[model samples]
Target chain A: MFTGLCAFPLTPFKDEQFDPVAFARIINNLTDAKVDAICAMGSTGLYPYLNNDERRTVAENAVALADGIPVMAGIGALRTRDVLHNADIVQRAGVNAVLLAPMSYHHLHDEEVYALYEKVTANLSVPLCVYENPNATNFTFSDELYQAISRLPNVAAVKIPGMPFGDKVQGEQRLARLRELVPDSLSIGVSADKFGVAGMRAGCDAWHSVLAGLFPKTVQCLIQAVRDGQGESAAMASDRLSPIWQLFVQSKGGLRVMATAADILGVCEGNCLPHPLKPLTGPARQELEAQLTSLQLD
Target chain B: MFTGLCAFPLTPFKDEQFDPVAFARIINNLTDAKVDAICAMGSTGLYPYLNNDERRTVAENAVALADGIPVMAGIGALRTRDVLHNADIVQRAGVNAVLLAPMSYHHLHDEEVYALYEKVTANLSVPLCVYENPNATNFTFSDELYQAISRLPNVAAVKIPGMPFGDKVQGEQRLARLRELVPDSLSIGVSADKFGVAGMRAGCDAWHSVLAGLFPKTVQCLIQAVRDGQGESAAMASDRLSPIWQLFVQSKGGLRVMATAADILGVCEGNCLPHPLKPLTGPARQELEAQLTSLQLD
Candidate 1:
């Protein structure tokens, strides 16, 4: 029954190690701000870059430090075995549901794809959500596939990526089609941070969000506005957050931008990313500060 | 100094474990076929999909099995610490050169990027090669940046990507410019397998190759033609292999198609990949077989 704004918090690191103290504070802030859910080890959390020990630590600390809020941990990898291994580790650490996306270097067959979810759901003791982010996974589940996966006993939710990196699904139609096809018991959430207002307004059960981690009030208010169907006010909030979305777009899908916004707002320390990825620099860094000041996230 | 046709073998996995026997066969085949170098853990080797233990094992096995061929190991990760950690493991395994790629989740600045190579190079008793594949790393090096990295104490070569995903740097000019700008002592190599003839004829000191792993005789033949500046024969050989290149292009940057090619030829059994990725399927599978038959690499 996962719903409302599912916050994806950025994993704060210090000295190239997962800093539990700093990360716990970020989780504490989001939970205190009263968001719907706190998700760690997401794309924003740099899950694929982490070692298993670090992932376990992040999941354990995020759940333990999130106070009473539901913590959904992403447990995806390039292989079914590794994905399950991470799922087992996180489930023991007490996450509500493990979010998954099957990432691969080659194109997968439809049957092979179906068997992956079947294998995971068959063994997972807890509920697991399907994260359909094609940009990273290169997989776009057909209507038939979605319907089939929904029947799996432990399937909890389906998170549709808001950023349409490829494939045809977009905007209101995507949410409508998913809501219609997937089993009603599964939560339907939108993950493109910039599109949260519109995604929520479109009747997505939740926003699997990155924005909420940086600007909780703005995102929480957007969630409430959409719930109330306050279209105009929600649009206004979307407009104000437009600058933030623009920065994410410029930075190529929001990780660096979110880190910059979080760093500027004193939400975290050290703008350094896990290397190869520096914090937003040059023009984009300047624009982030400008957007924060304008939106009053500063 | 690593030069000439460097073969990058695909990592074969069985039961989700690295199959050293299958990989050892591929390494022996390439060395026996007389490639200039045997590179383990390159992108073609599926390094990122591997665990550190698997990576170290592959590096050690490739080096020990390479016979007299120099072994270059790819030691890149999303973090500087991990890259160096991998470098240490690979260096102790007796690889000739460690190939460093600055892969990132965030955009990096030039100075920080330069420092990554410097750090890894400084710590090594042996040499390192700069792998500038922007499609994966998302970091584009300037002409100035290339010259700077080339001057590092242990920097041996710069492998520029032959497949231009975007921003257009595909042919002879790319090799010619880099050869002119990079330090004369530093080897200049082209990484696109399809363009071996053109890349070598364009003055690339080496072809860091995937084709050589499976079709070593054809690649070796092409290398000789180009080295002899027998341009017409090299072009003819590349033309016969054009269908093979077409399969790679259809598969998008060639890993799956090459893997399928190797698998079909019985270069290794259990043509398995890390998951999410399956073997080439449908029309592409048929075409791969036809191309192999035509090239006689079958």
Candidate 2:
């Protein structure tokens, strides 16, 4: 089962090309920070925007740069065939596990969605995680779907969106409810910056994080605090990073805010292509800088 | 404004490779049958299942073999950037126009959906058709969405699923409503095998078809009858093809039953990957063959 903090790094581009060197630097830092697993080509990484070759470059480079850290590559596409093909490429690239999102161009029914995972895993011999990001996929997995998917081969974990933004009861209670539904062998991870500590407290095996990619110190501290059941330090870390989490919520993690944060902390260059959200600039940059200084990112 | 019988062609495969020769044969036959515009890489072509290179091959081969006929290539993906990239490739491949389905992996709001078209068209110099396959996208185009999208540059047409399977009143009233809302320049089409004559009778500007991909003679005849308001002949054509249409309805166009019809009619080998629906096997093929013989596909 996949566990601990999984860092999802941004795919930084340079000179209108996928800069493998720039991406490598970010992977090295995440590894240096002792992140358990590095997740590449996630929603945060803007997987859909990158071309096929760029995606391959990002995955291969991430694996090579990571110093023994298991790399979990996002391998979701509109078709099951493409996802399967992506899994094969990433596996060949030496990723430890693939985070598979059941992405679709159509409103897929439960059976069709389940069959997608089945067909994909039929070709997959490596470890896989079911990426249940409802915000991205528009379809939430029922406990039944989760149970069926868990029975699929090599399903090491299931990463659900942390807190399911805007739901009234938006904390550990939701994660706890999820834990009760899945099998004991199937690991669960949460995918929101705000809910990292709360997620660990709620029995999540890992924190599949976007913010942790940039500011690993706080995330690692938060993960430790929750593991020790020290609510105060967990609260402290969450409070310290509240501003960035707010930015993520507001911007939908599209802009290169996380990349900018990494750049500010001397991790990697903060550049992205096909900018889906407003990049941190002017006032936003100043605010992020002030927050980073206060936190002392190193 | 692409009008009349727009024959969408099947992407045939041989030795698990996209058979350009087989695909070209189907395209030639459609042109011979006098289809106005031959739309390649349509849903009938089993598009999403194909890889990036495979998709490129299908579009390019369709254009090269179309014999001077206007080709409308389907260009839809999980991201706006990818769509723009695909539009460039298909345009470079020499397609006249692109049929774009605003396919999303996420639940996109109206503004986000509108912005997708804006961003895509900003990169495109070619004509674009909005393929609002609600069943596929999960988001229906409201009159507000339609008006906003219509104002975007180069949006020439909109294709909505006709009969909206299982809606109590499965008729042309919705098409009339769509027509009343859209601008005069924006052509409206329906995507249902059963709705062709009725859609034309109900004043659909075009027929975005699946059956036309194979049996062009019947489709062209249906189109002409509808144009001349020959409801009786239209009914006869619809009646003649009802068994096949029934199968399409049952399968939701996943089985490539149309491709099977192409095979039955000796157009091209009817084979598809990642079959979304049940294939024409056992009793289904026998039933289809009897129906095809009655229509006399020669």
Candidate 3:
């Protein structure tokens, strides 16, 4: 009975240090929005940037903030050992589930991909959500591979990044096929909150939202509209949310954008994306400000 | 002065675990061949499959085995954090240098690529080698990016896969230009031990060998012939080694093939490549055996 929006919390950093206080405030804000589940240390949460200890701390804090709502921990890496290590940390922290990307440098055949899921499921005590973020992983699970993995024990759901901006039709077709393949008990989650209404109309079970981390009420309203078959209201909310998504996506890197948005919303004091990603460009910030105003989000 | 042959030790695994004893023995065998230096845990060592602790152990054992000879640790990953973590571990283990690959993701612009090297170099205490293994990384460092990274304080060298295998003249020309752009102190290392004599003739400072992990003596002999300016002897040695190289290349996945050959050489007890690479086929074994016999490597 998972309804409403799921928040993918941004991990806060101050002067290259993990800011638990700032992170706590961000998670507390998401809880105030009443997000159904909190997804911690995912791509949006900058999972890859954090060390094992940092990841454990973030997972524990996120679970505490949710106050009994499920906290799905993202625990995938190029190496299986590292993934296992992360899973152990999350499981010990008592998270609800593990979200994993089947990512590796080696070209994975279908059997290899299946084996990865089988191995992870065998080791993990918590329910697992197989994340199908092909852009990050560089490998897409075949429909056949997905079907096999979904049948594995403790695999509670599938997280699909529903159609990016242009590939709506293909994305919709994939979602439909996935829905038919997965059993009725297993949920199908969409990270494309902007298209949550369209994806829900196409048969998605859950809306996993990055935007919900910032604007929980608006996203919850949009989700409620979709659940209640109020397509017009849902579409209107999505239109208002589109500008914010565009602003974040244009800010060089996803983590930086997420942290900046968190800062702007007053959820966190300052944004600190680790090294390599520079601070926002002048034009990019101006564009972000204009978009926020246009959507009446400021 | 590093030149001629560079041996990458077989990362020994016992009971499906990283065995420092077996690794030390393999390193000892290479040292006996008077190999220039050991590139520990590079691609040939199955870098992607090893965990941080395993990587650290391998580096420490490599240093101990080298016994005053240089040990260059391979530190490459899709995530910048993992790469930095591995670099710090290797540096602490007292390896002479670090070898790095570009970030493993698609559509990475030149600036992003440059930033990766810059960040890694800033933290690394030892010398660094910029690895350009396009076959593995999928992303090739441009001459412009390579030139910029080569100028960093700790960047001592650049490793490029030897002469374009597919007769891509443009690639060869680019390599030639890259050689010109890199500082003279920054040595250019080449892979492809079979035609390494040719690579030496083409102006590379040293030949990086995966096959050397299997037959260090044969590889050392070939490199010595090349260094001594005995072209005919070097060509003869290459001809003798060609069959083994073909077998190594033909054994299923490229890295797996090398690992399997390492198994046969008793360098590592059986091949245990992580998910995605299956064991070698029956025909591959037959081919490997015949090639080993023909090369009189038995």
Candidate 4:
């Protein structure tokens, strides 16, 4: 049940406060779309920007509004004490799982990163996903580190960055190599929304997606096509959004682009991002609106 | 008065709490050495790992215990609102100056970074130091960004990463170029302790140091020799500590090694670092002790 499209939603804010009504609207939209799981507080959810109390409030709202679908929350923080503190909070708030990125200010050693996971996983009452996001966290997990972490108890999945595999042969070989390292019980999920179709066709068990948070049916169909072995359909689906993917690349990462898309779709009211992160502005905003109109993405 | 060796002291902790007594010992050591300034809550101080209230207490103690040494506190956070909030706290706690690093989870655009400094500086009653520790913050500041930020109100200094200038000629030229870009009012400070001697000899106005936190007199002599234009003596002083400098290179930016040295020196009780960060272990610890003894560093 945990191994499918896990949509990461933006924790919308209004007047620098968590906008519960706006948040509920987005949650209800994802529920209606029946995404495999709702991951609140992912990077796209601005987990690091929010305090623990705000995160707990967001987690509770996610669980309460998600209908029967499972909910996961990001528990990453700069300190181990805070991560563990967050692990307890989200679990008590009734999340089915927690995603932990080894968030750092000081670059962490491999031993320290492993120790962080070991300490957190030991305290989890629910399944944990080892989030390996080098772009945001600046800590890359080696293949050996991955195998070691996957051996820890209650580790249900490993969310990996998208691979730039040129073809199915490379994609399959890469996934096959990773598969050999971890237990069969561990689901392999791919993020970097642009590469989800390629990853799904590469035989990844799940797509941890930012796009799916705002446009679930769009990504759901792409995943469903891959599952049904319709390679042409999945490829076409991904190809259709090349401009948006280009925008993701040019914007540095998906967080800003996804937030803009959410606001454009009216899923989040405009100007939803927290401070130090504004929505797409000027040409970028105009380009996004033009693309949405041409793509008929409503 | 703002320029010279600004010693960065560890905010020592005992049992997951700020150990003010131990913290006072480190501050007193820097004060006794007559360092030009004491910068509390730097990366060496584990600022990002500390919460705002904890940071407030650390700043208050630093100002109270510094004995009029011109205390500067780090006020960087992931959000602009929080940075402003911390600015208010640290300033109210009576810091003479505040350091802003533009700490990030998502990599920030240059425009966003400029806007961050703009927002924080607009509300500050005290002068600000632009902390450019890319290794820790993961956001590199361009020279143009430095130029822009240096022009902002309250920006008295720009702390740059220590450049690997091979000789005094290169250092002079590089510093001269940077000098042209910023106003004459801005003091240029260099960090990365291994390169501080070269930077100081090359005419950087200040050395923002980690080693100075634990062994203030040791670093003080090096900076002092340069100030007195004792070229041969300064070179010799730096050359004598080649092995310690090599340790900083191996130990990943001096935070861990400083923590270990602090414990060994009894400046901090053992296990002084916050969780997810540990002091040097195994052979690294043994090697640090051997070097300390050989160098007669107190």
Candidate 5:
């Protein structure tokens, strides 16, 4: 079973090139924090920006630095072949598993969604995890689709964002329903680092996070507090981290903000987003720095 | 000056793999048409489904088949690096220009959009064309951004889709306004085959189309009628081909429909959309066949 914190490192680029040394440094930092696994090339990692060659290089470096720890590569695209190609490359690099996100030019039906997982898993040697991030990807698979995908032989987990689905009662009901429906062998992970403790208390098996990439020790402590049933300590940790999370999420470009914060925290050398996404402005950067310091993360 | 008809060949796939031989055959057929150039790997070509190697191979085959005729490759992606990588590969394959779509991850500010084109053109040795297909790609670039992109040193043309902005008065006013603002050196091509005659009458320099891929003679006749000011004849051709266009557009999947139509016409061997997009079903196939017959393209 996959447990503990999973750190999703931001991909580093410099001078229109993938910076391997900077990537290595970030992975080393995560390793030092003893993160159970590393998820490379996720939305936070900007997988779409990396071509096949760059993705292969990143996968190789991540697998090497992971040093026996699990490395789950993000494999999702508008085209299934691109995903398959990336999966093949990452598999060759010795990554432990692949996290699949169903993204495309149009909304997909339940069967189409199931077929994607079925086809990918049929050819993949490693276990697969289904990621449901409806915000980044406009298309969200329905519960029926998720149930079908979860039943696939190679599917091992389902990762959901931790934000409340309207009311707390509905959120708890949905969680309880999913927990009851998903097979026991298929682990359930939450992608919400902001409410990691709360999600854990509500019964998520693991916390998948972006902030964990920058402050793994703090994230680890927060998770541990919840695990140990120390509610007050967990709340304090979450309170301290709230400002940083808000800064990262509310910045003009949310993903770009996380990349920039990673640079400020010394987790990566530079914060550069791919084309169409520019760096935060002077005022935005200054505001983010102020928030980071106020949260004592700087 | 890219005047007259421009054909974008559907990228051929056989048994789920890119069929370069079939792709070459389609290009060879377009040579007899009055097409000024051939566009390979555009959205009509199902570009996102192709892997990097397959993309390179398609470019290579397209260049070979076109002989001295210009072949432009679509190099748009969510990431600047992906676009650059594709541009580099296609340039190496001897493509004349790269058709670029602005970053579609989010609605972009003018400066950010300008920066994307500037960065791409800076690295590209070949000329580039700005493809404005806002209907398919949710993010649309403003007129100011298009004007700025046109001023870039290597930009050669702008490809606009057919849908009018509004009523006749508004449409005419908008076109007149654009003509006044945009320079004459940069040609504007229309990708609307259905409204080809109207667009030509409105002073568009060329027609970029998908229907032209299968029925070159009909498209050529339609273009000739428009050029000759035979409005009734051009309208007749448009009416005849309208059903085929509707079937292609209304089909469940864009790429799948094109590939299936190619297969039905015997231009390609089979439907080869990458995963997440399934082939046409029995009902869809029957409907497409009937539509093609009605258009006299079968």
Candidate 6:
């Protein structure tokens, strides 16, 4: 159920409230492109910022509008109870899978993390994706922890941070080590959009992508080039968006940059991110617009 | 309002529901101890696990039971909107201050964190404590960022993680460096129960202590020793509790160990920590029980 390009669209906001119209526009772009899957309420969707009701609204809409594409929604939270609550919400909304990051307030131990997945998976009706997002959650999973969690019921995939930037050999070695630990049934997905193609080329099963969320065709072409074993073509396709990747780094992850690009491209409002997360400003905003215009992908 | 020993009691639960009776029992103990202030709903209270309604329940109960001692409630959340919402709830519940951590799903920039404090403080009716707890929040603050945030309205204090373990000179140096950056009005408090004394001896104005949460007299004596300039007495007091400190190290932080001690002493139920945060078990639990018995802390 978890394979290929998993596009993550922003849960668009206007005037500090959810703008379902703008969200449908984003989801429709993914459906029209026929991306492998659409993952709503992922970190790129600002899952943590929204309350359960808002999350349910996004989940129901994403599943409804994906035009028969499989949908996954992030159900990660600080508590097992809330995670279970979110799992029920997304599952009731008919999402095909749920992504759970062991989000924490106190840093979790390996055993505690294992217990979390064990408890969560026991209650889940859908396949569960282990979201190993250390940057956001402060919980890094060791190979031992991964092996333990992947063996749990309904475990589908593990979404890891993108490999060391541009280091294909290092990426392959890391993937190789992880591959040895988990069963073949548990898919290994990669995030961190800048080096996503490197991870895909290194044999990651899916690119759980932020880039694909905004520019579906662009990322799809790159992934397709790789699937066809056209290495140089894949590299060339990835290279075409180097300027945007640089902006992702400059802006610190894709959330702010994606919102800015979406705003500049007229896909969403001028300042779409939830409060405390401002859209790009001044030189950063100008550079993104200039780069987006040059790419001409919109 | 933030000064001296601000005890943080666990919001004890039973049968998967908040045991307000157990909560009040813990609170009454602190009120009887006359700790300088009481901080309910800090990390030790598992603020992240509870919903706003639950948090409000805890806040209201904490204030009602604190007997005239000032109360501070944690209002930190992933979104600024919710932080404000929590701020409103706790303020209405009559907490003297709110503790705001720049809790993140997306790792925040210095500017973003500043914006969060600025926005939150703008709506706050009570003073705000900057909770610079990197271990849980995964967002570290630069000294320059500290300087910027400390200038905001209602910014009362900064609760830092404990100083480097057993390194008094280093603790003092770190505090000195920080002292130069923030206003004198912002009381600097320290957490990490094992090193609470080191932080206090090094000139921290308060200990936002997990140890004080459960064993108020034990921790208060140590602080009182420091206030009297009896360095040897303070060190001796800390050393006497080395067994529990070792347990704190073994358990990663004071939460599990403290919960175990509370259970063994019959202050709360046997498995009192929220679900997914299991109580200490097997040899760890046995060892803690033996150590507590030997210490005759009960």
Clashes of each: 1, 1, 0, 0, 0, 0
DockQ score of each predicted structure, in the order shown: 0.39, 0.20, 0.30, 0.77, 0.40, 0.63
Q: TM-score per candidate, in order? A: 0.91, 0.75, 0.84, 0.96, 0.85, 0.95
Predicted complex 4: CAPRI docking category:
medium
Off by over 4 Å in 6: A164-166, B164-166, B296-298
How good is model 3 by TM-score? Answer: 0.84
Q: lDDT tens digits, residues B1-298, model 2?
A: 3777677777776545788777777888887887888888877775655666887888888878878888988887765656777888888888888887766543445666787788887777788888877666666777888878887888888887776422324555676566677778888876776777777767777887778777778777888887887977887868777787777766555335775676676665554434333246667778888877876743
lDDT of each: 0.77, 0.73, 0.73, 0.88, 0.76, 0.86
Name the candidate, 1 or 3, with the larger TM-score value.
1
Winning model by lDDT: 4
Instruction: Indicate the TM-score of model 5.
Output: 0.85
Ranking by DockQ: 4, 6, 5, 1, 3, 2
lDDT of 3: 0.73
lDDT by residue for model 6 over A1-298, one digit each (tens)? 5789999999888877999988988998998999999899999998878888899999999998999999999998877788889999999999999999988777777888898899999998999999988878877999899989999999989999885536977888899999899998889998987777888888999999998888988888888888899967888767888888888887778899889888987888688888788888999898888888888763
Q: What is the TM-score of chain B in candidate 4?
A: 0.97
What candidate 4 gets wrong by more than 4 Å, as runs, is: A164-170, B164-170
What is candidate 5's CAPRI-style docking category based on DockQ? acceptable
Docking level for model 1: acceptable
lDDT of 1 at B129: 84
Q: Cα miss at B42, model 5 (Å)?
A: 1.0
Query: Per-residue CA lDDT of candidate 3, range A58-174, in tens?
Result: 888887777777899889876566788889998888898888887656555566678778888999898888888766666677878888898999998888876642355766787
- How far off is residue A269 in model 4, in Å? 2.9
Error of 3 at A234 (Å): 4.9
Place model 3 in a CAPRI quality band: acceptable
Instruction: Please name the candidate that would achieve the greatest TM-score relative to the true structure.
Output: 4
